[model samples]
Target: MLILFGWRTTIEQLRMLSLVCGHCHNQAAHHLFRRRTKPTIFFIPLFTISSRYGLQCTFCGVSYDISKADALQLGAHV
Candidate 1:
């Protein structure tokens, strides 16, 4: 018998929302991302190991990690 277990990481662009860019210092379209990591058993996700949020400044081409709540708030279209 053999047992196999591993981890998997996936990066996905959640959405692009209208948000103020700190570097640009103005309202602009920004990209939101969700980086998810999970434990995999037989290539199936067993459970979530970790999750991260990111905000990307399209104007400045910079991206940084941010809190999920904060990112959501800032990502809200207004």
Candidate 2:
């Protein structure tokens, strides 16, 4: 029997916030995202193995990692 199992990562946009970009120093909208990694069996995803949050500036395209607490508060409205 052949068994196939691996990990899959998926990124989802949680919400958007108007904030200043750290790199470009421009006031613009930043996209909040959730990145989740899950174990998959035969292309079917199982429980999440790990999760991360990020904020990306729309103007400069620079991305930064955010804390879970901040992500929850910002994503609550969405």
Estimated TM-score per prediction?
0.68, 0.89
lDDT by residue (10-62, candidate 1, tens digit) is: 98888888778888787877888888899987888887779898889888887
Which regions of candidate 1 fall more than 4 Å away from where they truly are?
18-28, 76-78
* Candidate 1 residue pairs in clash (backbone atoms < 3 Å): none
lDDT string for model 2 (1-78, tens) is 988999999999888899989899999999999889999999999999898899999998999898899988886332
The TM-score that candidate 2 achieves is 0.89
The pairs that clash in candidate 2 are none
Whole-model Cα lDDT per candidate? 0.81, 0.89
Per-residue error (Å), model 2, residue 30: 0.5
Task: State the weakest 10-residue window (summed lDDT) of model 1.
Answer: 69-78
Q: Name the runs in model 2 displaced over 4 angstroms.
A: 75-78
Clashes of each: 0, 0
